[model samples]
Target: MTSEKRESALGALQSNLKKGHVYRREDLLISSNAVDRHLKQLLKSGVLEKLSQGLYYAPKTSIFGRLPPKEDDLVRAFLKDEEFLILSPNTYNSLGLGTTQLHNKTSVYNHKRHGVFKMGNRSFEFRIKPRFPKKLDKEFLLVDLLNNLNSLPENKDVILANIKKMLTNFDLIKLEKYVLLYGVVRTKKTVLSLLHDLR
Candidate 1:
């Protein structure tokens, strides 16, 4: 690959960036045939490391040798679909959820079902759930926030504070709507109980 082509590819990669470690060929360019060939050459030269077929990451050299590619590189490559959002293991762990319990390699909850794809060595999983009404953003946010808070480190005070913050910022009507939508009566009671305790 010529320096100019290589530079252009790198520039593209740096721009249009997303969270996590992986990227897709389509993401790199509108047309990736030439870009893929050049990227492969870069891989052969040790300029980059191929995580899996069609997935690559810039490798960092250590005094001992080359370090392994970051896990996010593989994740970014696997999670190319715009419809599904990728959640890191930390995020999952924070949510107090376990990958083993999920029984899928790559699991994401969405409103619509989609087929899985393999990128590099990892497998991606998608989950389709019922969709909510358009006016329930606050409610959905609170539900999501509660779910994630459960996964966070155990700190009662912190959790209470966050819940209060969420309640303060959220619309009460939306909260009621979300409670009805998710059937989270116990969660609503818990929030109310916590607020009472705070008082």
Candidate 2:
């Protein structure tokens, strides 16, 4: 492509830019034959930000300043698939189980990619799982809380005691369902034991 024509193609690619949306190099190639060269120019001009090797995003601005990419947008582009869940471990705090740990990490549960990946200023820990809830609910969080008990810094016995006392607060059936669906062996045994004691 001639320099003049290449600039025109690059301009077309830029016209379609959506703030807060991530794009892979392959996605941009559809619009510009001069991808590599134009990518460098775009990055240098701050029109596009490099997220990772082949991942890039158009920066979004707000009164607060330039906002980082959304968790879903970032992960979707990174995995190249939308079938994943992004959650913060701190979210479990809503359970009101005397847990107040704060974390700067993001955890992704998906059928693809395992291990930590740094994209821009954020860090996402991806774990491979054959299954995960489509969304969050109190019951699922309760089950997930137990599922990840070993990793919690709080005293396990205390939490268990509190759970037994608060057991009436959750739907027993949903709790059981999530446990059977998502729990590891230890969670299953612990939850079943707790339920059995109530009988």
- TM-score: which candidate is best? 2
Query: TM-score, each model?
Result: 0.39, 0.95
In each prediction, how many residue pairs overlap at the backbone (N, C-alpha, C within less than 3 A)?
A: 11, 0
Expressed as tens digits, the lDDT of each residue in 27-55 for candidate 1 is 56663436666566656765655555667
Q: What would the per-residue lDDT of candidate 2 be over residues 14-96, giving only the tens digit for each residue? A: 99888889999999988887789989999999999999999999999999988999888889989999889887779888988
Best by lDDT: 2
What local distance difference test score does each model get? 0.53, 0.88
**At residue 191, what lDDT does model 2 achieve?**
81
Per-residue lDDT of 178 in model 1: 65
How far residue 81's Cα lies from its native spot in candidate 2, in Å, is 1.3
User: What TM-score does candidate 1 get on C-alpha atoms?
Assistant: 0.39
Output the lDDT of residue 12, model 2. Answer: 93
Give candidate 1 regions above 4 Å deviation. 1-21, 29-33, 51-53, 60-106, 111-116, 130-176, 179-199
